[model samples]
Target: MNEWERLRHAMRATERPDAVLDLATVMREGRRLRTRRRVAGAGAATLAAGIAAVVVLVAVDASGSGGTAPTERPPPVAVAPPSVGVSPTSPEPTPPPTVARDVPPPKALGQVIDSGVRYGTDQRVYYLVRVSVPGAPKVTVGLAAGRRSPNGYLTTDLLVNDVEGADRSAGFHQIGYDERSSTTPVPTFGYFVGPAQRIIGTVDGQQVDARLARWSFDKNVVIFWFDPAELAPGKRLDGIIARDASGRRL
Candidate 1:
């Protein structure tokens, strides 16, 4: 058992009091919550791949040719703004030695934006993505999934949303997950970007030519994305978004 669980178990073993029983219940609930989150992570990755395939086929058919096409994108709904923050550097790890590097970064004018879709059957599941547009100002992106509770799904809340292009100067924005903010006992993992290698990233089904801004562990799950213009062969995706610069500029 984990440390938290161990403490609860010890308390229950000694005291017959109702408080001890209550602590045990809390411990069980914590375990259940953690398990649910882990399940969500694995599910999101798999769903992302399936969603990617759907996007690619549609993108190819929409354009005369299969080549990545630049077009109008959907708009983002006006959000009070999830705690969006930029990173001083890309969030992905550096590339391997074998990978070649180009001195001049390629242009990312027209990244294809992924159309809005319910990634999974759950009504609360949705993703917001920004296309890797060439020469576009750094824009913010968000993804929100509703919380599942015994009371049924609570109103869709901002599960995770962070900016991908802020420098060290920019303050950290609210990432929405707070329990993990205080500790690191939980098993955590994330991606990183190394020097000399292009920070290549795949979104849903599209190969985006953007670099990472700030991908980090929000609880055990990590939230990560890249700048639309910074990515090579940038293809911007179109979506209906509020306060989206991709619509205004690129």
Candidate 2:
């Protein structure tokens, strides 16, 4: 479609295959435009709005794809299997660490649910999970806030050391499963774990649980929803979750 057509569809949250974002490149690619400062300013505004609008549209479109890589490298989305999955060939094994150092609770819990990075019972490595809201549309807004490995890579929540008690959890090398919509040990909406901030102390008289030590840089937000579906095989919500004192996702 043409630029006007693409922009209109984007505003309406429609999907466009083979969509290119470089307008200047597009002009250079085949089209042309005025070189005046005033013209450039007008062009930039259109580009900014188009980019912003495309984010929500593309995010909405991609949401149907389901389950993303279960790592902190990128944000998480709740995609189902038959799409995203673990490879048949497992990765090389890594050693586990003990629990994270215990950190005192934050003063208040807002929207963010941070589980501070701490070594578990054997210096098990771990990462802080961050949640945006109770019923995030896709997967929970997750972040990786844990010990940097020898190679300087942050440990994704897959490492077994931190999740040793959570049954046979794969360590950092393992891929992550989007669980924003997945059921938790408790009946809840969306959730996250990390150090404390904005999400802390926002809601009054609220009870928080399963809090994590939340860091500022490692923050993610999700607009989620909750469902009361029965337990699914190969799926379980068993683990040690730390929450803010007020019971919210960081």
Candidate 3:
């Protein structure tokens, strides 16, 4: 009993008065602590989001500055080369030269039929002859005049006619004729198809004789010429007549 009583007295001596609790103050302090905890959690979430954004920005800057980005290149172009052995400003090619051809001289066929000298002029002479050519079907008859120079060279002028369709049966078939009225004494001459013995020419109502000759190769072909001095001034030969060997008109 004593031990129990002593233990009880010690307890009573150490014990104080009973504590009084304030409900309203305790509730307000509890609410304020809960609010502070919520605010601190929200602030920590915002700080984590800001740190993630900064890391993403650093990664993008590193890729661009370090030259690791992909880029596209343009396509290649075509070009033409210059031509060989040619120039833009060069001249055109030249053509070949032309060549000249040679010509042949005229050839005679028969002997001279008639020849005569001008009156009082020995340096000038006239003649009649015939020539043969390669392409002609018949012989060509020619009347020619020649003049001699002081150097003993002779230059000739010739007038010719073709005798392809002469009428030998007629009294006269004229071959060719020429008159030189510009001379001091007008000269007239002609050749014909004939077998005649004489030829007469009339001028100014007077009869004049014409010298007649036959070709050595054919007697049917004849030539006649008149003395130019016998013609009166300003008058021409008006008519011509021929006679056969029997003195008959031909």
Indicate which candidate wins on lDDT: 3
Backbone clashes, each candidate: 40, 72, 0
Task: Kindly list the per-residue Cα lDDT of model 3 for residues 1-250, writing each as its tens digit.
Answer: 5998788666645544234589899999999998997787667666666676576578768773321322234698332111111111212221111111121222333333323444344344334444443443333445444333445444443344444432222344332233332232323545556666666666655666656655545556666656556544234456666666666666
Q: Which lDDT tens digits does candidate 1 get at residues 21-135?
A: 4788899999999899778866876677667667878877797334332333359743211223222222322221111111122221122112122224323222233323233
Q: How does each model score on TM-score? A: 0.18, 0.20, 0.41
Candidate 2: tens digits of C-alpha lDDT, residues 17-132: 23559877877845344456546766776676677667757777978432222212346743211111111121222222222222222221232322222333212123334333
Cα lDDT, all candidates: 0.31, 0.30, 0.46
Residue 153, candidate 1: C-alpha displacement in angstroms: 44
Candidate 3's clash total is 0
Model 1 misplaced regions, further than 4 Å: 1-21, 64-250
- Ordered from best to worst lDDT, the candidate numbers read 3, 1, 2
Q: Please list the residue runs of candidate 3 whose C-alpha ends up more than 4 Å from where it truly belongs after superposition.
A: 1-109, 113-116, 119-126, 129-139, 145-164, 167-186, 232-235
Candidate number with the higher lDDT (2 or 3) = 3
